[model samples]
Target: MAASARIFSSANFNSHVKNVRFQLPCRNRQRLHLRSRQRVSKLSLGSPNQRFLSLTSFANFSPAQFSVSGGCLDRIFFGTKENSCNWNFAPTRISDGPHGGLFDDEKGPEVTVVVLGWLGSKPKHLRRYVEMYNSKGIHAVTFVASVTDVLWFDLGKKLEERIENLAQELAEWLSNSSNGRDRFLMFHTFSNTGWLAYGSILVNLRDRKDLMEKIKGCVVDSGGDPNLDPKVWAAGFTTALLKKNSSAIYPSPDKSTGPQSGNMENGLKTEPKETFSIEPWMLSTFEKLFSYLLNLPFAKEKLLRIVSCLSTDQPHCPQLYLYSSGDKVIPFQAIESFMEQQRRAGKEVWCFNFGPSPHVDHYRTFPDVYTSKLDSFLKKCLSSVASPMPS
Candidate 1:
């Protein structure tokens, strides 16, 4: 529960503030979205060790009227004058570490994949995926969303604007290429947080038909739940906070079944065993809390709208879904149902069910198989973009 900052402004604040810090009570960890049209930055109030905390304290606070000031907050952001915000929770490992050369080795005129990390995920968490794409000669832009991002509804406008700016930059770079090589954009999302981030990008690019057409595919890993579920949200937060110690039941992989040949009808093959690391009471409490907050008339409507847009208002491109039965966060059935829905709508869809990989850890557990499926799908997508179907 580190005091992460979500900046929504330029670097002007960086010069004005220095080493200023604030603290919220340990019991009251709220993700506040402080936004001002002219100049304002949102900061998360929590303890130094607390991560992926809660929103219980701000039941009556207003996102607009609330304001905070600090320089340590400024240390969290690295933005140019033109962009609202770029990265989230600027981790030392990604900002100044070896991963600093994240987009260095671009290979060819192949697609550029935007790797969006899950809630409470750091840039280091996505370094492997970025490296994979980089090794394949594909360019990548890695972005991680904070816990504040997924819990609230109205706070995403700045985030949306930031993503739109990124899309615009990529489009400009592609347009300026002297080689006239056909380039494309693709999204590789880790969990529901990353998937929602992708949805926000689509929302911004919806009007830019040219850019929309350039998007070739989306790779959904461990998430594609079309609708918001309280239980899933609770589980996701639990996993983010506790990491490997959470209630995830990681069963052995059923090597007999391949990703394409699994029984798609059933969800989980065996009943999950309970883990004592995260107590059952704690999970149920989180579920009850989220159920109330998410069901509020305004929050419910806004969240549902955001999710529904992902289903009907996306780019016309092929989709690849990578999920597993061992995931304790998002249910595999939800992903399969979404895939079936997309297929029925005539959109090109593909999926692979890694029988026992943990949520968002399929690549870590089964690197060879995961990369094979991803490589195959990416190739197919690039080929389709190169030779688009006759409209």
Candidate 2:
């Protein structure tokens, strides 16, 4: 990472941590990755899809059964669904001091950047981004959904209600915090899980034109797959189940040995080295199982609604997509096709292909390049706030 990129590093991360503190409920000691493996093994005893559907549909599945890794996971999985405290990845905060770059008084619009994290991502997974935005003097509110939320997104109403509550909070914040000066909202999403949650927020805000006008742009990172294809769903779910590490099952592009030892900003360890390979048959089986689960009538309908909302209900704002040809989870063609569609609809769009970065890990791999592109896009979006860009 270059010196410019290091501007958004551990220092800002710690600053935010100290400012926003929440004492969450006690968590279970058992690690979720271990339990997930055991659950997968148990599924082999019966039809995988049938077993999964039974678990999701039955109200009898205990909190212990769906347990995740830390106190954050316990709060998210077992806490009251409608409580805003349990759902957001981090509490919202405004820029506490002056910033130097694009957001200087006359140069850019005052902006609030809402960052949505990928599926199964913990708060630690999103720390870098919070640092990135907050260091830029931009307010950031980070959010992530549990695997259970994504798995049953449309089948149940809890996630929808939580999203609505989030939207309401954003609306209130924009209204109250503006101080008579123009303030804007920019959405930054990671992977499909965040992208879909972004869509749900759009749905909640559709009827509120005032808040809709406050949205100046969106940045979609490692996402924009706009269909309900089971294969893609299977790939995403598989990655989540294996966890987001760059092991053999989810190796980095170019196959270089990953970082062995280094401390990232915030004292986070570098990615662990690859240790094992996953068999091809496991992916095939998961795909077959998802094909059955996703095709169920109610599930299919909910998925279609999500896809449709993203396509038709989005606000008229500039869009930027950050993705890579090297990503195994999301095919590059899907992103290109989606971008082409947006172009045809006369929407302003920008994209960056970080040639060999892994899904949602572009910043970690190429922080300089990632921050450079993002900085450029944010400048463009703010520059065009009061005027339309020429096609």
Candidate 3:
């Protein structure tokens, strides 16, 4: 068998991460409270026309931690030094590129890179990506959505309100910037959670052609499949939950019998499932229940329509999709088909299939290849812009 074929025979890492669960508060009412390690937020759903109220409180985390050495702290915290709202922006110097040096000194066009991170994505992880963009003289802003946000989407509850709020914030931040009108916009989204947020932003800006034209391109990693199987959805959700509540559900791995010694067939690593035992029947039952709920009259149709819009209604710009065949949480065939559809529609789409790397683990498995592809894509996006603006 070919490497990809042999790898298909082995069980995936989903089995190792499948046992964790978090008991959410009752969703019977229209309100939900989500408590995280550093913050607590309340969300209230109202009538269709009424505005939804969401309150989030941050504790002890400082904006200073995000500041790069030569970057302005104000620019890092606000969209610009003049803005007062708490949008997370972090400006950094690019020492070697064409737009190299401090923002005040850079000689190239200013590009604003907005990153939407996946569920349970850590601040450190997001910061790393931000730094990468900063190193290229691109002003980077990042938003990390909590696991509760994904839960809301999974239940098809108040998702619009949540996405609307984010879109408004982003729109306001960009519109108010001193140099907003001339700046090129690019988005890098990680996983389905990020894709949801990105889709909402697109929906909110559908009528704003001025803003839409400013968007140069977008890069989607490990997600954005138009159709997600219920089983795959459940597995991805389970993985996110495990990551969020890692301290409670995942015991420290025994070095002797954990990931290190696990089998690696056809370049794909399979973790030992003994650490977390989830019966196959349990997964089947969960999938059935989830499918039933999702297929409830009108609900599935409504959700599918929303997803269809996400896949087909995006702004006409270049898009790059990075996915892996060994991603157990998302079927690679779906991604391939979506790419094909985009091509058929005459949209500019590029894809790199990194075979055998687990979901979102492409960078880890093939760092050089991943970085090379990303650099090429970024250059292509920049080349399409006629002129670069001052930061």
Considering only N, C-alpha and C atoms within 3 Å, which residue pairs clash in candidate 2? none
For each candidate, give its TM-score against the true structure.
0.68, 0.68, 0.67
The runs of at least 3 residues in candidate 3 whose Cα sits more than 4 Å from the true structure, single-residue gaps closed, are 1-92, 97-108, 154-159, 244-270, 273-275, 279-282, 297-302, 386-391
How would you order the candidates by lDDT, starting with the best? 2, 1, 3
Model 2 / residue 233 / CA error / Å: 1.3
Error of 1 at 388 (Å): 14
Score residue 172 of candidate 3 by CA lDDT: 62
Stretches of candidate 1 exceeding 4 Å from the true structure: 1-110, 152-181, 252-278, 384-391
State the weakest 10-residue window (summed lDDT) of model 1.
72-81
- TM-score of candidate 1 versus the correct structure, residues matched by position: 0.68
Global lDDT of each candidate: 0.62, 0.62, 0.56
Cα lDDT, model 2, residue 201:
88
What tens-digit string does per-residue lDDT give for candidate 2 at 1-391? 1011011123433332212112223322221221123111110122212212111212233324443344433444333232222223222333443323344344444577888878767666777777676666566777767665665464566566656667877787777753465778889998888898898888788888999988988999999999777777767766666654434223344634323213122222234565424424335545655655576678777767877888877778889999877677888799989988888888888998866567887777666667767877777777765332122
Error of 2 at 25 (Å): 15
Residue 244, candidate 2: how far off, in angstroms? 5.3
lDDT, candidate 1, 199-224, per-residue tens: 87777677778888888889999999
What is the Å distance of residue 258 in model 2 from its true position? 17
Model 2 ranges with Cα > 4 A deviation: 1-109, 244-282, 384-391
